[model samples]
Target: MRQLFGFLLLFATAAPLSAAEIHDDIDADTGWQVITAQAGQTKIRVVPAAGFNVFSIEHAGRELLKTPPALADLPGVSYGVPLLYPSPNRVRNAQFTFDGKTYHFDANDGTNFIHGLVHNVPWTVRRTEVDAHQAVIEAELVFAPGTKHYAAFPLEHTLRVTVTVRPEGVSWKYEVDNTHGKSKVPFGFALHPWILYQGERKNTFLTIPATQWMEAENLLPTGKLVDLEGTPFDARAAKSLEGFVIDDVYSGMQSDHPTVADFRDEGIQLSLDASDDFTHLVVYTPENKNWFCVENQTCSTDAHNLYQQGLKAESHLLVAEPGETLSGTVNYRIRDARGHKFSRWEKAIRKFEAQDRQHPPAAGGTLFVGSSSIRFWDLPKYFPDRPVVNHGFGGSQMIDSLYFADRIVLPYQPRTIVVYAGDNDIAGGQSPETVAKDFQRFARKIHAALPETKIVYIAIKPSLRRWNLYEQMAKANDLIAAFAETDERITYADIATPMLNEQGTPKPELFIKDGLHLSPAGYELWTSVIEPLLPRAN
Candidate 1:
């Protein structure tokens, strides 16, 4: 019955649960078991059945991290934990040439050589033991030479990862033994832990001790280290991970030592420690997402290629001799530092907000505002013929639109302001009336502040996934159009009408696989709709 339910869920979510549904025991005597234990002020346990993982820290029975459904299914499993050959974050064309030969690997998320081949592969469970105070589990994963999945790199390797849990914290140790006899194997490795937390990730505090940072031209490291001075990349202290966009790799760390990252707020305090072998850390903070990643890596993106380029030092490469093994560890601990974090987070938010508020949006160029979908849009390409200033944020509602109107929309003094919003507000469960009112408020704010500026409200797009809210969205559009009618300066651009299919629903071809967001075709449609309304190129 459990297997049936798991299989059903896999199809429903479109996310495979092969790793998550590994039960505690295989029938009566064939599988692994889930173990639980408590230590000190923290409670810890392991899933010996699935990768021998450890998880669920508690102080007085309260969860330290947000236990979402996806997380609960894989109780103690860590996602994207790298082994053997750590993949690069971004690769040119998702393929790299090594030793004058081209190698192709799986592109997990559109463009990057993610977590390597070992990710999602099952590891054989070896042993499991649990006491009232602690639980320890161990596992061994062997990759045979010339295996089809890993045929790109023909090297036999035996990888062993051990996980230990206690009330103090949970620790993971990885050991990779090169079984390919007598020949040096060039490979990369990294650990990507899917961290979850409650409330806003922007409220969290993070610190990485490094003397210098690496600069990237196109996701590939330039092998250069600039001093960490007056840049957002500086993580020398416990700074709030808010309002800063980062997807770069940092090098020249104090040591090839495990660095500590802490998040303290809302009655919870959590800390993560990476191993000494983990030299580089990639900090990924997407706009408005509830979670952020502080990935510990042994080398930078495309390390193998970088190695060939002689861009990376010989010391940075981990060349395991015949029968030799490479090893490392990572630890996560939870504690209570709510008061400190609350005050710190509040101050941080105020400081960042003030910085944003101080810089009011100028009214001279094209002003783009609203949600991440807009922010993430390549403005240069999207408005190739016009000068555009991007002001879109992720997960922002109409209220945020009004709030940041001055900083974002008003600053450009744009001859024409192109507004692309309301999608997130609707998705956030806001009523159409409420969204309409917010739009009205936004219009009023813009008009009052810069009466000469022309306001062009792009109609809310029809998304296939959010078709249930199509009627409400149309109603909101109607209200906005009605409001536009009252002002000569306000113009409504009817994009939704053209974007709809014959059935009067959102055209599926316009949406990406996610159904809610636009694909390249959708963007092209938007570009066509907006091109005419924009002022003639100066």
Candidate 2:
């Protein structure tokens, strides 16, 4: 079932979770520590002592980060995310040979040592700072001389972690300073964030842009890398998260763009972005559990072992020399994707709502609404006599207006709604019939709320550049005009006819240089036709 935590949620910090207010404190135990930061509505909690993990990420009023309600129930299970280093995933027999020295470790995972040793130890808080736009915290955990953790590997080094939260998303940086005078340390760094879900897993969709899968046995790599062809790990695009119980490592990440893994269920969506340095990704879906992990690793599991065995040309181990720093950054963007026809426009919706708050328009007016064409329209200039409220957001689709209707439209209680969308929707791959149906649904919705109010749907005009979709546009306009005829309150404002020339071809004078949007004279022509339908002043 869907759950709501305390009212003090992180929904504001939820999406594009980036910011600049940093706060530092220690856990009640004192052995653990915490750093809380805020950026706009985005709020983030970084627990440095508890493996340098993010304890909470709240936005608006919802906590997007997942955690075990209790930490004591399962041994070695990280309720929060865990920062790992030096052979990240698994080491065979908890041992590896480095420069003739066979270093051994305690097998924490039955026969393998997973997630590294520093994840359980305390990290000293180095610094904390905040600016107007972002908040950052820096902490370090050093491998002390003669300590058991060091003695097992006997490497003198310090691993520093810095996490910055912003209104857009949270970014993390990991830097390892090799203090050894002569020896170059070979190590792996990784993060295991347990992003969980509520309700049905079948409803949720997952996306990870990876190209290869690491062939492993018993969670340990067998020094073989293979393509993701016909395998269950092929998540090149967004697909279902159910049916395939995955605990696998994938490599060959898409370097041209920021590596992203998107998770969406019901109305909520979360996207994880990583630096180009994060070439390897580990997708861990525990058996019969609600939580899943999309981990970013510097190298494949047992990188040191793979490098020692000479099976692969490069094992991705950051062989840092003395006094060198190896670092990376990762960001998390959470959003509520309910209103959008497509999932990716969550940011645009948030921006629109924010814009409304910043510039509150007067209600009970003739509201002009739609995509960019309507957004860029000079509403007041044309309809000077009438009280006008323009709620045209970004390049919005007809469905987008529907999704955000409650917040953008109905609240205003407008006597008339003039819409000019559907141009971009068809370009975005929707059929002409779909756009017309969406308009019909939109009219029905408006009539349901305000039966006396009028709804004027502007016929999609032909653009010289978008002449290819003009046929589809004409078909959609025909359908909308027909539907408008069914209701006395509905009015179809046909602008397409005036824009067509003697040969029924588009007039270049109607559009701007881009041939997509309207020009001043174009609005003049629009005013000439649409002016007749608009209610006149008393």
Candidate 3:
């Protein structure tokens, strides 16, 4: 029954378990189709009549997508997530030749055609669903002869988009069919979402896993790719968007990494995960603007013209033969960092859980948990005959261990648990008293679950690189040592004392060249000090 309950719980959590709501209503004043979907902490508003744009996304009571003040102003406003199709951004000279046919567009921006023809037009709603798992709305645009959209390109096709809202996040699936066209059509697709900042724009950090940037002239791709190394345009890692003035196209997207926007002041992280079909990402951070855009595009800007000019590598233009359909998906995920204290360790915890499921570690064994010191310790090499389970995650704090105790600690039903943390907490500016209290809280939580289980608190080690913080570390160790004396099940080991030389400084042999992490000699010393305190297996 216990095993069955575990499977049921996993099934329930694998998908959204709460009821979702979605409906299509008309605006009395504007007579526009206002579709809304809500599930859990996420709510999305889509205006299908106004180009099927998702204008608003509110999560945890905070607006993540930007919108105009008045719904009437949507025709002129490009703040919402708008679909850019056929062509994205500007096309050279307002025209491109495809299959012996020259297509001409209005020169809306100087000598170039900007955006697309269908972004501000009405779309036909096809489906709306509200269920226990997700809320969804599907809309389509058919471009045929006699329609304004078809007059611009003269090619017939249909574009269907489905937007889904669940507890996890919002997703968009786009399907394009060319059965109505007489010949193959060259096209592109992209989403231009004007991402808003929760607080000051300077406090937000942006990351794009792009290896190279498209070389451009006058905001148009120049058919060249430039390496991003040592360039200001390089945002391969999380970098503050403060004082940045950028409007460029990036390519060579890393298939495994997602683009992330971290609003530090709001404690929110927005990740944009796109399918492999997307080959280019456009990052636009205008000067003095309150909003920015990280667009996911199936092809580069001016792709049709670029491909016509024999610059095929620069333009990832896709050609769909008659009756062919192309599809892709993009997801917008929001993470409330304020609520999940251990969110950064989510992947690590999941990996540990997967390992446990495969091997099924026996209960009443010794469990060691903490930060890098505990993670790097070779328990199997040191205690070869004993039953020990390592659940250490690097760079974790005392509070992190406490926050995830139920998932990683209590589930094991360990007879004894050893902890070695607080090093990072002090380095992160937490008070020594606070660190000691956090460890106390973890101990209390563990004891409450396993009344007879013993706990051993390993003293924070002294390292040459952090010798300046040794005084505060010593204070934190002393406080935790005092608390251990009050409980018979709790034990405090003094590994810090032996790690220091007669001069009261950390021994050079104990640490590597970085002077922080332990060397082989240091782990051996730690093993000698901690092994005796391990409880016997039941």
Best by TM-score: 3
Cα-based TM-score, every candidate: 0.51, 0.60, 0.62
* Lowest summed lDDT window (length 10), candidate 3: 1-10
Order the candidate numbers by TM-score, best to worst: 3, 2, 1
Count the clashes in each prediction: 20, 34, 0
Q: Give the TM-score of candidate 3.
A: 0.62
User: Per-residue CA lDDT of candidate 3, range 245-363, in tens?
Assistant: 79999988754788999987655799888888788999999888788999998888889988998987678888888989989998898885445555688778777777787777777
Ranking by lDDT: 3, 2, 1
lDDT of 1 by residue, 261-337 (tens): 45443434556666666677777777766556666666776676666668656226566678788887767666444
Residues 1-538, candidate 2: write the lDDT tens digits.
1122221132222122222466555444343445667765467776665666776676543455575454321123366567777778888888888778888898888988777877766678888888867887888877778665677667788888888877666777888787553567788888788776643677667777777788888887776778887887887767677786788888876445444434343345777767777778888876678778888887888888898887543367677888776777776776545434433555655675676566655555688888888878888888888888776766778876764554456656677889989998888777787788678767766665566789999998899988999999999999999988888898999889889999988999988999988999998998888778877754
Residue 279, model 2: lDDT of: 78
- C-alpha lDDT of residue 477 in model 3: 97
Clash pairs, model 3 backbone: none
List RMSD in Å for every model shown: 21.9, 10.4, 13.3
Predicted structure 3: clash tally: 0
